[model samples]
Structures are given as structure tokens and as C-alpha cells.
Target: MASNPPAPEAPYAPVQPPTDTFGYGGYRTDEGPWEEWNPTAESIRPVRGKHRVAKQRGGGFARSSTVLGVGVIAAVSAGGMASANTGKAPVSISMPDLPGVGSLISDDKPAPEAASALASFGSEAAVAVDADADADQSVADAGEALRSRIMAQAESQKTQVEVKAAAAAAKAKADAVVKAEKEAEAKAAAAKKKAAEEAAAKVEAARLAELAKQYTLPTSSYTITSTFGQAGSLWSSGYHTGLDFAAPTGTLIKAVHSGTVTEAGWAGAYGYRTILTLDDGTELWFCHQSSISVSVGQKVATGDVIGRVGATGNVTGAHLHLEVHANGNAEGIDPAAWLRSKGLNP
Candidate 1:
């Protein structure tokens, strides 16, 4: 111990390791009479190694959900492609039930075994992709069937509507045609009725003109002194039943129409009266005449001289009293209305 020189005194302090660029944990350096103590295994716990939480490319659960969504999209896209390529109808494709990848992630513990399970799921996903084409064909078939049914229903409805519209149009057209026909018939009937009336009027006018040519006035330069049905004491019956035409005593009288002389010369009260009988059994009496020009049974034409006007028996002045009896009726009708029936104004 004397051979070695004494060393410098050192302060009592904890030992510290040398500094280095490489970071290292410190080591223990103690020299003392200390006994090594081993704590109870139950009291002390084993320290676990420090570990880092590995984040997925996105969040773990979110990335898992994204993968599942991508798979579904791929399946649908494959179905569309199958429908386009194959002429055959497609059948429905049911997706296989899959375990959830998000449930495998944990906040506290790392899941190394879950990664292996995920690798197995990846294999299963590959199998699903391989079978996707067939599944797409089935789904396309089902869609095609549904579309065909809907199209058929629509086409049927359209056809029904068209038929109804056409029927209605036809009915309306028929009704219009019938109405037009009826209207035309009615118009034609009206026109025919008007034409017949015009023709009848024209025929009547011609007949009247011919009758006027045949008929003649009883006397010229004479005036109507009295009409039929006059009440007076001068008449023997107390009522005049004849038309009286006044004139000078020698005025000439003529036959009104073609007729036969039934009686001529003096009839006591009528005074040189002439009786003319027409073809229709109408008797015309010219009373108070000065002279008679026609004999009994003599056929006289219309306008032939029959008598002369004079004041004779049963007369107040120079006048011709004319009476008419038709159809053996002794009582005479009004001469004015009777003359109008033959188209005469007198």
C-alpha cells in the first residue's frame, strides 16, 4: 500500500458516465457495503417493452370500411359489364356475409393476430372478385325481367288509350254525319214545299186570266144603286135579295158567262125578266128589263146581249136587278162574294 502514492481527495457524489454523440442509458457505478435485495416476485411486476401504435394509411377502421365499400362497387360494376357482354338474361347475385374489419382494431393493444386474420380475409375477397362476373350476370337478368314487365304494362295502357280515343272520334264523326243528313233533308223538304206553293199560285193566276176573258159586265155606263140583303119597304119581301145596277132605260145588258136562257119575257113582278141557267145549275135572273134579246132554251155565249135596263114593274128607277140562285137554293147569296169566287171584282 506504501509503494503507491496517495491520490487526490474526491467529493462524494453520484457517478456520471462520459458524454457521447450516441445517446445511451446510464450505467450504475457504486462501491459500498450494500446487500443486493430481490423483491417478492408478486410485489414487483415485469416491465413491458415500449411499443408504437401503427396508424393505417388512413385511420384503421376507416380504411377497413373503405376496402369493403370498394369491394361492393367492384361487384356492381362487374354486373353492369356482364349485362352488356352476354345476350343471356342475368340472375340475381347475393353478396356473401363478411366479418367486420373495423372491429379488429383496438385502442389499447396492438393486434398482430388480427393482421393475419385480415390476410385470410384478403384471400376470401380475392375469391369473391373471381366469382363477381357470374353474380353480375344473375343481377342483370333480374333487372331485365323487371324492365320488360314494366314496358309491357306501359304499352298495354297506351294501346287502350289509343283505342278509346279512336272509338270516340268515330262516334263523333258518325253523329255529325247523321245530323248533316237530317238538316239537308229538312232543307230540301222546305224548298220543295215553297216550290209547290209557287207553282199552285201561278196556275191559279193563269186560270183567273182565262176566266176574266170569258166573263163580261151586265151593262155599260151603269152604276151600282144597291147591294144584296138591303132592308126596305120598296121590296116585296121587305129585304132586297139582288144587286141593282142603275142606268138609262135603254142601256144594253149582256150575259155574264156562257149559259142557256131558261126563261125570257115578262114574269109578273120581275117585269120582262130574263132567266139564264148555267151548266152548274146556277140560275141568274135579270129583272126590271125593258126588253129581252134571247129566247128560252137559247144557248148564249158569254158577253152576248141579254136585255135592256128599264124601270118596269116593282122598280123605283131605271135599274137592272140581278139575282143568283145556285144548287136550287131559292134564297140568293151575296153577289159581291159570289163574283169574287169567279175572279171578278164587281
Candidate 2:
């Protein structure tokens, strides 16, 4: 038989529970070297696969999901930043469809190389953003300049229009003034012409009145029976050669002007007639007289009674036939005209 195992020790040792070095129970009277050491990542080693981190119930899975979600959010935010840097609209990022939830939480740590690449990308994106901003500012400045130019041109045009309007108004005002002045001048000239015409008329009237003062009619109450040059068969001449003044049978006839009696006789056609010669060599013949009052060769004043009118030879009524011989012409002139020449209207 195999040697029997050494005799078992006697059961005198007391049984003891497991000792706890981690101090979970509470205080420790003595401090260890581990307490003096400040643990750094370089000094500490990560737990191997054999060791596992302990967690509360249901906490480990939730923490892993949260970390995964944060990583996805960071990636999407980086993409948005890239779009903004490129001056493009931001695009929505969707999570890739993974076959299992484990894929989302598989790796929590990022690689060193990827982190360096993200840093470089961020620097380039910043440069892109600055360039975009500069371009945008340039465009805005150009637009502002264009707007300013348009405003300036509009202002210039408005000023020109105003100037033209002002000039036109001034010209119209000046024209109105000129027109008023011309109208006033025309009215003044017309008034002056009328006044001159009236003055001339007054002077002519005065002259005619003075001329009329020197003239008178032959007899006061006599009526004109016939004018000179009247066509009649009663006279020896075909036309009457004297003016006939009808009166009563015993009416006095007067000398028309200051003259000398040239003849007082009964001619064939004139019975008991008289003739007078004026200082101007004009002869006056008074026929159809009833009787003669002045003798021949007698000097007589104007208006002296020379004869009385009666129905004498070749006369149909009591009247005086007066004839005027201008400058001793045989053909007798019209007595009416001769009287008018001496300012007497027959």
C-alpha cells in the first residue's frame, strides 16, 4: 500500500474568515505605499481580459450606448462644419444601419492617426471658412457701390429737371411783364391820338365861326323861289341865270356888300333893276325889282337898301332875281356859290 499520508495535524487551529485588504469595511490605521503614489495612465495598466470592470445592474450597457451616441453626434457635427466651411448648405447625416447594436459600442477609443487627420482637416476647414467670408464681404461691397452710383445718378437727374423748371418759370414771368407793358403802351397811344383829333376839330370850328361873322343874308323875310341854273322855259336863256328870292310886293332889297352902284335901269328881261360893283371887281345884278332906291354912280355901304321887289318884266311873282358876275364874265356865276365864298350860306 502507498505510504499513508503524514498524520493530520491536530484540530487545535481556529477557523478564520477571508481577510479584506481593499479596506471596504472602513478606516485603516496604517497607510500603504500605494496611497503615496499618484496613479497616472502611464504608470497604471489597463485590466486584462481576465479582469472585468464591475458595474451596477443595467448601467454598463446604458453607459456604452451613451458614449456611442456622443461619438456619432461628433461625427455629424464635423460633417456640418465641413459643409459650412465649403460654403455649402449643411446636409443631414444618417446613422448607418448596423447588423447589431454591438457594432455601435464595439470601440470606444479613437485611433491616434485618425485624431491627427481630424485636426488637419479642421485647420483646412478654417481656411476655407475665412476665404468664404472674404468672398461674401466682397460681393456685399460691390452691391453697395452699385447702389450708391444709382442713387447719385438719380439725384443728378432730379437736379437737372428742377433747374429746367425754374428757368421756364422765370422766362414765363418775364414774358408776362413784357406783354403788360406793350398793352399799356398801346392804350396810351390810342388815347393820345383821340385827344389830338378833338383839339383839331375845335380849331376848325372856331375858324368857321369867325368867317361866318362877316356874312349875312340879303333880305330877312324872303323865301327862295328858284336857284341859279334851273331849267325853265319862262326865261330867255334855257337855264335860269340868277337866284330868285320871293317877297311881298313892296320889299326892300339891300346891297350884299360895300359897293358902288354901276347901273340902275330897266333892261329887257329885268324891269327897274339895279347893278352894283364891289371893290373886288365882282358884279351883282338885282332884277324883278318894283322900284330903284339908289341912283347909278352912288357909293353905297354894305346892306344899303337898293330897290323894292315886285312882279316886273318876265317875272311871275314879287321877287328879286339876283345874279353874280365874277370878274366881269358874261356868263353869270351861281349866286349861292358866290355867297358861300363870302362866308354866307344861301
Candidate 3:
């Protein structure tokens, strides 16, 4: 605590830690925090602890930097190797659920469960489409059958129309035939009526002509002395064959009727007789003629000078013997009755 003593002196005066060079030849200083001790090159000197600081700043700092660089290089190499091997980091996606996720990515990716379900639906759609196509075909077949039946009906109708037309034509032909037959029958009836009328007219005209052929005696002084069929001894053939007209001589026997004298000749058994043939097949005899003015085959008009009458043969007295015969037959009908039927009486 209190005893102080004098210390031993260094041999060379312990070099004063080099005097701090001052002035122009010493340290440099300023108002900054660190000051320079030396100002000139002459006063420059080394510091005492410089070596130690240099050592620490040199090798020790270099060693530590190298270590750090090596560590960085290793880290880069590891990163490059990991990139080359794996290509990229694994990615994760967010989705709703497995139940509905396939419906969202239908354009691109397909999940396993989703792909199986799609295949099943495709097969079912194909079957449904096939069934629809078959149904359509059946419908088409039914329509075709109906159309064929309609066409058949049309053909049958056309056939029926043709039959009706044919029947109408046949009926028209029959009607024409019947009409023609009726016309022909009517014409025949008309012709029959006309012919009957003509025939009746002709017969009536002939009757009138016959009536004109007969004439009556002017005087009712004559009688029939002999008949055509009177059988007696006076007749040459045991029959009174000729008609007789007994009248007084010079009885005006003007004319029997208006007729030409076809014959004016003598007849045997009628001496001095004159015969007059009329236009008809009738012979008129005027027997016992006093004279005859007409000759045979002479055409004489009625009331002409044909002859005069006289009893010249087989007469009881001078009486006119008149006889009438038809077609030169000696046996003749009653002249009076025949003349009455012709509208004349004698």
C-alpha cells in the first residue's frame, strides 16, 4: 500500500516510442475522427501492431470467403441436378368431387371412372338409334301397303266405268232397233190400207161399167119365150140354151148399151139375124133382121145403123128374136137378173 522505491534505469534509455513527427516532416492531422501522425515522407514510420492486423485481414479473411464460395457452388450444382432429373415440380389441381369432376373436363382429360361411364352410355345410344330406325321402317311399310290398296281401288273403279259405258251403248243400239221395227210395221199397215181402198175402187168402177152395158126394152110389150136352161122339145140339145126376147115386129130396139159393134154377122139357126158383140165378153143377137147396115168386124157406135130386127127363122110371126150370151156360150145366165145387179133392169 505505502512503500515507494527508485526503479533501475534501461541501458540505452528505452527508446522513447518514436517521437511523434510533427510539422512538415511529421504526421498529418485534420479535424476528422482519425488523425495522421506523419505529414511528410521523411517522418513516416511503421506501426507496431500492423503485422497482426494484416495477418488477420489477409489469410484468415481469404480462407473464410473461399469456404463460402465453395458452399454456393455446391448448392447451385444440386439445384441443376434436381431440375434435370425431375423436369418440374409436381402440380396439384383443385376440383369439386369425383362424382361431378368428369362433366367439367369433357373436352380434354378423362378420369378413369368417367371414361367407363361414357363407354356404357355410347353403347346404349347406339341401341336406341337402331330401334328408332327399325320403327320408322315399319311405319313406311304400312304406308306403302295402304297406297297400294288405294291404287287397286282406282283401277277397279275405272273398270266399272268402262262396263257402264258398254252397257249404255248396247241399250242405245237396242232402242234404235226397236224404233226401226216399229216404223216398218206402221208403214206396212199404211200400205195395206191403201191397197185395199184401191182394190175396192177398181171393183166399184167395174160394177158401174157393167151397169152401163145393159139397156131395158123401151116398151114393156116383150116377154121371155124361152129360158137358157129350159128343157123342151123345141130346143135342139134337149135344152133351151139361148135367151129369147119376143116383141112385135118393128119394135124400136134402139140399142142395148153404148158399145161398138165387134161383130155384125149371121148366126146359124137364127136366119136373117144380126149379131152384135159388145166390148165385154158378151154377145147380143138380133135375130130375124129385116136388114143389116154394119158388116163383120166393123166398129159401130151405139145407136148407129147396126141392124133392124125381124123374125126370119123359127118365129111364129114377125117378131124380133133377141138373145144374149156370154163368151159365145150357148148356155147363159138370166140377163134380167144380171142387168139388175149392174144397176139396170130389162
Candidate 4:
């Protein structure tokens, strides 16, 4: 038999880099030179200067999604490899150390150096996202607190205004009540004073009405030519001591009140005189009369004719000279005043 053909290689087998320990190697294949690469802290660090990564347009969402998808794919590949080798003897598989090739491997500690850097980048991105969310929540909470404070202040102001208005209204009502009470009191006082004055006037009127029934005038249709207390040479006294009523000759004179005739006769200078003594002992002298109509000691009623007017005692004209002596006193009082006391005008 012909010698067995050389074992066929898998089409997608990983290419191994040349075993060189220094600088760059010039290993070539159909795709390109399989350059050797070794990961380091400096090589894995993010590029700066002119070779720096450009900033993403929208946000970090695309970067985060890419990182998450890579992690998921690595985890799934690791799980599949573990399952496939569950009952097989351990075998050593070699892979080339090439530029950018470490990122595609799935292992327990996948791409050791590069994985650590990617994890650091993912952690920083997560931290940045968390910090932004926290900032947004803080601002929203502060705004809500501010709105609450404003509402509380508004309510407080409204309450104060209502309280003040209520107080003002109460004060106004109280003032009105006090003013009304004062006005009522004033009206009551005025009414009381008016009633008292009217009552006093009524009593005075009643007293005068009663006096009118108990007395009578001495004569009528006569003119008072002279008044009591008149001063002239026509009287024997310094002043007129009686009232003078001048009338036509022979006019009748009447008794002023019910009384007894104490004297009824002509005396010197008294052409015809009559003296009436009342029950109270007051004497009424009617002098210078034309004639006496009653005798001495005769009882006469009020309004009874007692004498006639004539130009008699110290005569000047036809008139009656009437004098009043209270309580039998010889000195006479004003006849006109005494007549008024008994409810007569004159």
C-alpha cells in the first residue's frame, strides 16, 4: 500500500508564531506575517496623544453593550468547552502569541492581562453610570423638597391672612354692638326726662283747676284803672295799698268768696263801704262803693252782690277800691295778687 497521506490539518486551525524571544519576527503566511506579541501593563493601557480612542457620539451605552456581549460570549464558550471535555483525558493545546489574538480566547482566566484591563474599564464605566444616576436622583429629590417648602409657605400665609380678616371682622362687629347699645341708652334717657316734665306740668294744671272752683271775682265788666302798689298822691298811704276797678256809676260789686259781712255802712271819706270776713278770718274791704247791699254780721255766699261802684272815699272817679287783709291784720296785702292766689286773673 502507498504510504498514508500526511494527516490533514483542520482548515480553521490557529497559526503559531515563530519561536523568537527578541524584537519583531518576520514570520509570513497567506494572510500576513504572524507577528509575536506579549501583553504588558504599558501595552494594554489606553492610548493617549495622537493615537487616543475617539469619544462616542451618543453615550457610553454602545461601549457598555459591547463589553457585556463579549463577557457573555466568553462565558458561553467556556461552558461549552467544559461540557465537551467532561469525560476525556486532559490534553495540552497550544495557541500562537499574536497581536490582538488574546481577545478571542475563552478560558477560566481569559486573556489574563487584557481581561484585567477590560474589567477595569468596565468597572469604571459602571461607576460613571451609577454616579450620573445618583446625581440625577439628587437633583429631582431637591426639586421636590423645594416645591414642598413653597407649598407649605403658601398655606401658612393664607392662614395668617384669614386669621387677620377674622379678627378685623370681629372687631367691627363688637364696635357696632357697642355703638348701638350707647344709642339705645341715650334714647331711653331722653324719653325718661320728657315723661317727668310732662307729669309735673299735669300736676300744676290740676291744682289750678281746683282753685278756680272755690273762689270768685269781686266784680265784672269793669276796667282795672289802677293796680295794687301804685305810687301816687291819690292815696293816703305812700303807695297804693289795694286794687282799683273803675266802672260806670252804680255798677254792682259782689262778694269775693263765702263770708260774713263784718261791716256794711258809710264811713268818713268812704261813701259806701262793706267789710267781708271769710271763714279763714281774712278780711276783704270794699271801699268807695256807691251803696252797701248787706248789713253787718249777715252771711253772704260767693258772687252775692255786696255794693255798687261810685266816686266815693277820696273819690276821683267811679271805681271800686278793694283791699285784702289776711288773718285780721290791719295792713293790707296786694289785692290783685291775693285774687290770683285764689285762681282769679285780676
Better of 2 and 4 by lDDT: 4
TM-scores, one per candidate: 0.45, 0.43, 0.35, 0.45
Indicate the TM-score of model 4.
0.45
Global lDDT of each model?
A: 0.73, 0.71, 0.58, 0.74
Return the TM-score for candidate 1, rounded to 2 decimals. 0.45
Q: How do the residues 1-346 of candidate 3 rate in per-residue lDDT, one tens digit apiece?
A: 9877877753322112224211113322432222212123354355466343323321244333333333333333334334434454422223334442334234445567655544444465556567678778999999999999999999999999999999999999999999999999999999999999999989987886665654544224777676667787765678765556666666555556555555555666666666677778777766766567667776655555555556766656655665678887866666665555565555
lDDT per residue for candidate 4 within 201-223, as digits (tens), equals 78866776687676788888988
Per-model RMSD to reference: 18.4, 18.5, 36.2, 12.6
lDDT per residue (tens digit) for residues 17-49 in model 1: 334211334445553222223233463455457
The true-versus-predicted C-alpha distance at residue 322 of model 3, in Å, is 3.0
Candidate number that wins on lDDT, 2 or 3? 2
lDDT of 2 by residue, 215-238 (tens): 456676888989989998988888
